[model samples]
Target chain A: MNVAKHMLFPDVGEGIREGTLVKWLVKEGDPVKEDQPIAEVETDKAVVEIPSRDHGTVLKLYGKPGDVILVGKPLMTVGEPGEPMPDAEEAITESNEKKVEVPKKEASAAPERILAPPSVRAAARKAGIDLSKVSGSGPGGRITAEDLEKAKGGALAAPASTHQEKTLSFDYGKGKRVPLTHLRKTISERMSWSWRHVAHVTYIEEVDFGALKELRGRNKPKAEQMGFKLTPLAYMVKAVATTLKQYPRFNASLDEEKAELILHDEINVAVGVDTEEGLIAPVLKNADQKSVFDIAKEIGGLSEKARARKLSLDELRASTFTVTNIGSVGGVLATAVLNPPESAILGVNRMKDRPVVRDGKIVIRPMTYLGLTFDHRVGDGADAARFMKDLVEKLENPAWMEKG
Target chain B: MSRKKVFEAQIEYLQILDEKGNVDASLDPKLDELTLKKMYETMVRSRAMDKKAISLQRQGRCYTYVPTEGQEAAQVGSVMASKKEDWMVPAFRENAAYLAKGVSMRTLFLYWMGHEEGSRFEKDQNCFPVSIPVGSQVGHAVGLAWAAKIQGKRQAAITFFGDGASSEGDFHESANFAGVFQIPCVFICQNNQYAISTPRARQTRSETIAQKAIAYGFEGIQVDGNDVLAMYVATKKALEKGYAGKGPTLIEAITYRIAAHTTSDDPKRYRDEAEVEAWRKKDPIARFQTYLKKNGFWNEAYEKEVQEKAAREVEEAVKKAEGFQANPEDMFKYLYQDLTPDLRQQMQEMKQSLEG
Candidate 1:
């Protein structure tokens, strides 16, 4: 009751535009069922098991896993349990399918074989190994199986000892990466690409902390009592915002069109929070508008939320400026990424005591280092320094916030 | 962790407005008199329409209606500033955008009344059918804007979705495409803090919905959807940049869904009244109304007039929509451009069965 036909791959609901066939279950001349695991196809989401559409003997295996297959391509051939051959032209479509895997099984069983699994068979044929001459190590030892490792100079091979082994190795100079999360994967690619293509210049400086320490000390307790910790972090936050306003150029991004600097009106800042998986930065939308109380409270809140993991989708976006506190982890200085699209990022290191001259007196005071990475495709050093100067001034005087 | 941090991005997370018609503008935009009044009016209209749609659903006059009672400013402001030619794709809860985009009250009601013709709009009205499948239309809007880019058209497409739709793969696909193509598309995610009964805190560990846009390329933004003017200005700038072929913009409108997800859903089951009441104090419409009435742009008389006007218009649409005859065979139509031989035979058989 059956006619000859090859089952082509169908476009399933998963929206896999194209896929790599991972491996095939059947080889030539193998009988298969209608719902047999014919092949494994890998997509962006996951590897999917594709099943056969019809039941029949596998006349041929058209493609192997790791080969890219388009939707609707021929996968396997099927016919009745005991059947006569149909015209090859009509039976197997160029767009139809075929299947089977028979290592060392005689390839002569089907007189109507059109194609092999891979084009590698042609290379093997050129090596002058007569099929009937070699003893087969493959299933059934019928001399039907070819080998990747063969004798070169008339050495007769002995039966191989079997031991299964798998190794995961690494070279000191080499590196391997398994994707952690899709987001981290994306971040790694973008950053590496940016580092490769974008001409990055780093201008880092160590600042005197004498005057700023006094200013923050005066305000810290008051901020703490108000349920806001006036940590050096908050002082830094205000500084970044204040500096952006003074040095508009540092706040500016590349406006490619007018061929000039495009300064933003609002100084929205983002702070990076360390999480178990990786780092996540959420923005404080309009930083310039908030008072010392508001900024401090918001900074503390956003950081805590990121830790406790209460951030909504909105809390993650909207920032014109950003700060990374690598300083908290005791790092003196490290270049930070520009976070892309945004023109600059300010990297902070831990506050440590150092000698500094304040108002003509030399004494040991708490000081930290700053590394500012800018998109020179947009900003200049003068712009960055001007921002730093204003920021330093603000950190030295929190009372200046009321001046506006 | 003692719940130490909150993602308090200025635009998305804040509560300065109180329900008794008071606002602290230090943390928010000070709504001007005229704009404030308009916000309130739109809110009232949206709420009334929501109630009407629920009634219609209860009466079996419509299939389903996703009400937007407390989220008027969110849906309105998300796409309020979009250009006429720009696209407006809705995920069912966007009655505000339908009104804002000028899709005509009659047409929107017609759609709910089960008329396919409801989706047929004037060429100038670039809106798509109300998408039932969550997050799918966002990718469609992205596609349209991308095509606009290929054609060099200075038009952006704005797509709307609820917080729940954010979890779907299509949302990621749409966002990724918009970012990759830098297409003029605005992804307006209304984070009403709930996807059905599930709260916002459960969706994902991502920092923000807007941040998803950054993954693709351009910028992700969170705007106060309840603060109408804030929503208006932010969305405007994003759309302006987008139309100039800058890239796709992701605007997450942070607001509260004051009512149940729909008339069919019971918010009481999943949410407490206390939480709802707290958010009600920050209601966008009331705050805007207070600002407007104080500025002399509106009063009780004007409020009553517009309210009556909107109510009448909606009521008329409902009546007309119900009166329109529905051809029973319309269901079998529009499967393809033209019916195939097999389909024609099936339809012929159906006619005989109906006659017998």
Candidate 2:
């Protein structure tokens, strides 16, 4: 008796949904060795060659080149060559398919389309009503803001008032319509999703970059010899990664359904690189284990690859935290959106010459703003502020950079 | 006593049709009128599709797309020479090659739209997905050919790359492997003069990219890439040699990148317009059209009909591509054969957030 095993496209990257079958190294009916590359699949960020785990004949291949295989869908079947395969119905109801069906709740039916103005729609959304159920009494059977208010009042058993809010409409001139690129679309969706799910609280602190500037100046030559230019951002990455060990919440992601915080063991810092396409955050993996100079070198290489659209899927995924240097673009401060699955993001602003009180005397110092935007679901405002305070203290003094 | 020279590589350049559209009858491959016309039509269709993709990019309907405007002959001609069963390993800029290989226009559009389904091909197709990491596909082609050789298969593998790719270590390694194994493979390099802002001259100090094949112990040749007849004849000869077990050969098709490196690049940043205008006079499609007209294979009515058909096909593909409901979670799927512990955790988190 021969038992056929179904192979599904694995979840290779963080939240990846599909992959394109680039090539099948083995043909159907061919005998394959274990650990042989059976197929190559191109995901969003990389072309991954999948290896066979078991030694078996290629019983059946599901997709051809250029066909997108969904995750959890059968990619191939491995069994004895020329063996009679199971029927389709049996395959469909297999254990792997059952796992895919387990989490799928019956989708709530979409609300019916209602013809309403912007203000009325806003009112309906604010009141949390199924707009399709509401009847309109305005012109041409249109739902007005008054109608939404009355519907809300009736639902709550409250008295309806005669007060009407004025709705404003403006004419905007036509301009060129630009379609969003894939990166832009992803950015837009992710940002909005972050805003909707994560309660964001940003804490800003001013840090003196005087000590950092001196350290960078002293180490610039040594860094150059090691094939990397020392920058303030590298030092900040080190400081943030070190401080994360003390405040684990900032380095964690919240699984709201399970109400669990995932504290990552390795410090994977994502650095934002601006490209002609859009902003991409490439990860500097295992940053906690790397020295400041090593981080600097990796940053240089990763940024170049990111800008060239050459980053691999591994570089694009599994970022435990993010650091964006608005200072490179000359911004004083910016509150960055939390890259979800990661609870917090650090934004470093430009250092400017400012008057500072040194021993009761006014002195010029290079001061910069550091903004920490965190998911309030994971931590409180006080905790977020403390993380920033620790980061600032480490930056203001150069001892941490030397010690670690 | 003086030592005699052991070997010298002679680089032969093939040009059946000149820039003036004048064909050398003696050098012509003597293809049937119908096949020649089909080749011409395919080039036009490829150009039409490219134009549509660029317009789509400008309209924000597609992602960053690389246009194959001026080098249609090199792509179409080389692909036309291969048998249907032969393998084709292409770089990201091989729109014409894909078209010639019977890849649907909708699939191309879907790919530019960032859909994974676009890259998936049917079981019969021997073409690989567009390799984005420059010259990396060369090694895959070599390995594929080696596999065929070991399996006693008669099929040959043709790999496409650029002058910029020839500078990569992967290309040299693949060339060396192909030479050592004596596998049936053809390396076609479209020397399109520029890799982004870097010129071909800066890519290599060698007088000709074709000469680089000599060090790997293989024959290499050059051809006027804009001349379809020359490209076709050279590729046919190379494929024949591969089938005859004469090992791999590299063909350097001298061409120009008429468009920017990609939609995201600005050619004006580094290149001069006058230079572009000069290349326009030697456009592959225009020159091919002239040849077809001389052969009585093309007329005003036929040209118009072909263009209309191409436009209609491209529009239909655009529609089909737009019909896809791209799921964001699709990115996380098919990343591996099985989810690792970390990936499983990430998926659970993603599912929860999406649910909320």
Candidate 3:
């Protein structure tokens, strides 16, 4: 039988919803084996080679290089040798029920789609409010959770009503509208999934980083000689890794279907890096098995790769634990969302001079807040609290980092 | 009114095999060489399967598993003591008991993988699926035993749980009911010290878990859970007593959870490495293997062959489990023989969502 099989673009990495066709490894009429690399597609993480799942001849190619393809959209077609080719328009009409077309004018009117996170969208939906009617106040005019709350409280009642009444008369060319990038779309889906699925309980603790600062100061020259800037994040990763060795639940993932917690033996710490495109976390594999210097070096290299968009799928995935340094990005404190499947994520905040009573004497010390968001379904609150206490103690005395 | 001494319970402790692989002749379970060798090999095979499960979980091929590293003797010996026709109820960590009862390893793997088919077994197998809720299996075992009693069947039911389950109210209720009815049921409590991260000390204030059975008007005995011979002797005696219509018996096996509570747990959180090392020296499989070699029933070559055979069996089981197709809609099928209106709607909705 000369049946044709349409191959869609598979998810190349975790949470990747779309990819750009970088190059077609097989041309039309080329015979290909099952599992052969048929095309190279550029996902948000890296360039991945999409393989053929059927052994046959490539009957038709759907997209050209540099064209964007949605996941589950046909990338190519494989059929028996010399089969009658289906007309492109006929193929399009047959799959038209699945295709969605957004008119240009309608796309510009919904500018809020480019900014708000999933939680905000969900809250807006539940409140029966149109997201386009609510004005965003966050960075890049992104809608915050508070914005949704205010909208629910009728704060935007006037504008919303005005928008409804002016629906027919409103001008479409009043403001510029930008399309959501693949990275932004991916982040939206992933963050929404994480927020919805994980039972997040965030615990925040403050640590005196005086000794750590002094240690970093002493090691700065040696680190400079080694060709990498020494940062507190490196020390934080080390402390988290060490603490996880003691409290393994934090270094675990929850499989809800199986009702099991998957505790990982190796500590792979992911550091969230902000780049020009968006936020990307690159993993530092086997952090527990590495020394502070080695961790710092890998952190430097991985961060560079992240910013340059050169991180491989391997580097961008497989994180048993995550540490986001909001401190470097100038935040005093923030509760992070649990990375999906991972039981916990640690957020490091900015360090500032603070006065505190130690040994009945008031002294100014460098202190920073460590916010740990954990999946309560996998562990108890007491477990998270104890883990935080141990982490604080380890960060307070980073002399352990110098031992190895 | 003058106060009078009402009740006193004397708990007997059994230890046939010591840490040094020395078996007390008086307490020895005098089985033939073939059965002795089989018991030792089963323990080794269980250990091999446990290691394989751990590695497979790490590789993302399986879901989280509770390794039965230090409790093999408690599992294998008790299951071996039960007759083939007797009912066996198991908690989540009773891999040794499952393998010993001739349940295919693939069924176990499929169960852990979250497939409903994994719970399906032949009618005559008489082995229940793994129970996740702590101590709930006790009631089921008691009910099964009571049903057998009512039917005039000679089969006894053996239920396996942990020390953690001893704290649950179900255990108390089941024990009370079993005692009142004088049913043929054996409650095997493998006290592996910690329930997840909580220590056994926190699980209960009582010094001995077996003593709890005395309050229900039944005999309670403690045994060295690391000693296979002791476990066999104690369980055998309890099963015999049950079959003789003497009521139920709670056998508390003193053992340590050498591995984490599960793949998702870290024993180091609430336990000391030195304590784990101390327990390592008293490993049930190691002790049993040493006893086997000392009795001329095993040698290095035979041990190697046993491990190889176990590995091959586990590998084949993994392949079979991986090959099995999982149907999501099958979850609703076994819930009711005739699906209710609500359940039928749910099944339809699930099918729509999956198809979408």
Candidate 4:
């Protein structure tokens, strides 16, 4: 008796063209039930588990993890035990052929860091030779396919090994060696990565805090009634978001792999919170669309959640720009490191009563320094100056805050 | 000269059944036992299917779905008021209306599952495919009614739209055309308080959506959409007027979208949770069930049977829909009576690629 096989196709979400096969829950020949989750597929929006449409033994697993499956493409085949396989092999082979062709083309188009021809590089890849180690005999140290053949089965034939540098030890020997927490390790890795990749140019601007102070004082009682302290950081975030609308370059991310700059539509300002464990930035999503009072309350809640180590992943991601307040810590002025992907970060430092010449006479005014560290890859120092000037003007004349 | 009132218009509000499930006996349509039971069962099925569809979308079995959780009475009641010959033109969120008009649950599920085959209804079903562009279907509905009128058919056309559609120029144009031609049409606006994030208040400055019909020279009335009896009475009256060769009538059914605008939306972003909680009390299904029980048309056993039957039907439909094998060739077929030269070449190429 001939039994038909049931193919499980993807129906992840609307307008989702394709998804990455994250994992398969069931292997071939395993019996599965209807509506049983068969595989985890990551779509453009989120990771979703695609369930089996019929109860039967899994006949064929279509693709492995990291495989790109198009929408409406069958992920697997299920059929009765001892059933003969149908003509699905052709479709599977077709998809596999397409996937195989993509990577070969991408590898050939890689940046020309090493001096080698495409054919020679392909031969080196097949022979498992680290071409970078082979001293080329050609002009300008170009490795030929002949050199690759000669290097095969030799010391340079092995897969590229990671650089293992030795660390110099000091004789102090009396300090405790506590392992870094996951958060600390993550922060360290991200900061170092940002520092290495970003072309950072920080610009500092001095602004009078008279208008901002007066505005905060006027709203302080109202904010207190709403059960949260109205900090200057809220005003700074609001001002930054407002100014970012004009300076679109600052409210963007650099896609280094794609060599593109993505201008974010929403101004999600991730405010840096110094918790007991380390520092974490919880995003106040769509800060430009929100009122200062709402931002203040959200900041308070986010700080509480951050201190309690209870911030959700959604709250910690998709921040277009970052704001770090060094006021409470009493910093005169500080340049902050750029958050990875984000084009810029604003560091607001402590306020001070400084003597300034006003109308040719010396006078005391409350002032603060605003530092803007931006990715020069996205903009220049002149653009950063303009952004800072706009921000400083907004901070000094903050009558717009009352428009809320 | 002394000032005189040249013209005056008043919008009528009708409510046969209160929120507490008490029906005014004088205003009740007095539907037969089987018809009443069918109406209630259809609403319950719509609700069950809506819940299941949302779950399916979350589980990645279905795509984004526009749920009809709170506006079932408005949909079922209005559809039940029309005859089988009447045309049902619907916007996207009319799953209840479609179900009542003899469109299968499997078809709707398949459509939301991202299949074009789902939109191709049975030949006898006079319901149009789901329209995505807001208020764009109003013109098609008016055209359908105009065609019927030109052909000397007595069947009236009924269109379903949301409060957001009321602001669309298509709706205004269609209403004006319908009124000028005295076309046999019934326009039902499911004023579910929101069009995505834009609330009804922001959609228009009109004091009431029903009053807008006065400008188009038609009688418009508002009804408590959650009250099945009120919706049934109002729609019945409007359809009667439509079939009697009188001009079109607009029925503004006041309701709320208890769920998100669609599966992808987050109502919490714009709407208050307390508002949803309050609307939950006025749920159409629950309210109708109470009315049915008080009228001796429903009991626990019947309710259990209806619910179990709906659940079973929905599961079977879902199973059938998921098992459907859509042919790639169908994409090229049915779009035109004869494929153009360019389309034929593309089809051949697609077929060759697939076979390869």
- DockQ of all predictions against the true structure, Cα-based: 0.02, 0.01, 0.02, 0.09
Candidate 4 clashing pairs, residues 3+ apart or interchain? none
Inter-residue clash pairs, candidate 3: A263-B264
DockQ for the candidate 1 complex? Answer: 0.02
DockQ, candidate 2, comes to 0.01
Per residue, candidate 2 scores C-alpha lDDT tens digits across A23-46 of 798999888764567787766645
**Quality class of the docking in candidate 4, CAPRI style:** incorrect
lDDT of 4 by residue, B237-307 (tens): 88788778887999999999998788766565577778899999988888778788888999999989999
Name the lDDT value of residue B335 in candidate 4.
Answer: 74
Answer with 1 or 2, whichever has the higher TM-score: 2
Number of the top DockQ candidate:
4
Can you tell me which runs of candidate 1 are displaced by over 4 Å? Answer: A1-404, B1-40, B351-356
lDDT tens readout by residue for model 2, B163-204: 999999999999998998888999999999998889887898
Residue A32, model 4: Cα distance from true site in angstroms: 10
Winner on DockQ (3 vs 4): 4
- Fnat of each prediction? 0.00, 0.00, 0.00, 0.16
lDDT, candidate 3, B178-201, per-residue tens: 999998999999999988878888
Model 3 lDDT per residue over A22-104, tens place: 67999998998755778877765355566676788998888776567776567888889777666555555555653445545
Q: Give the whole-model CA lDDT for all candidates, comma-separated.
A: 0.70, 0.83, 0.83, 0.85
Interface RMSD of 1: 21.2
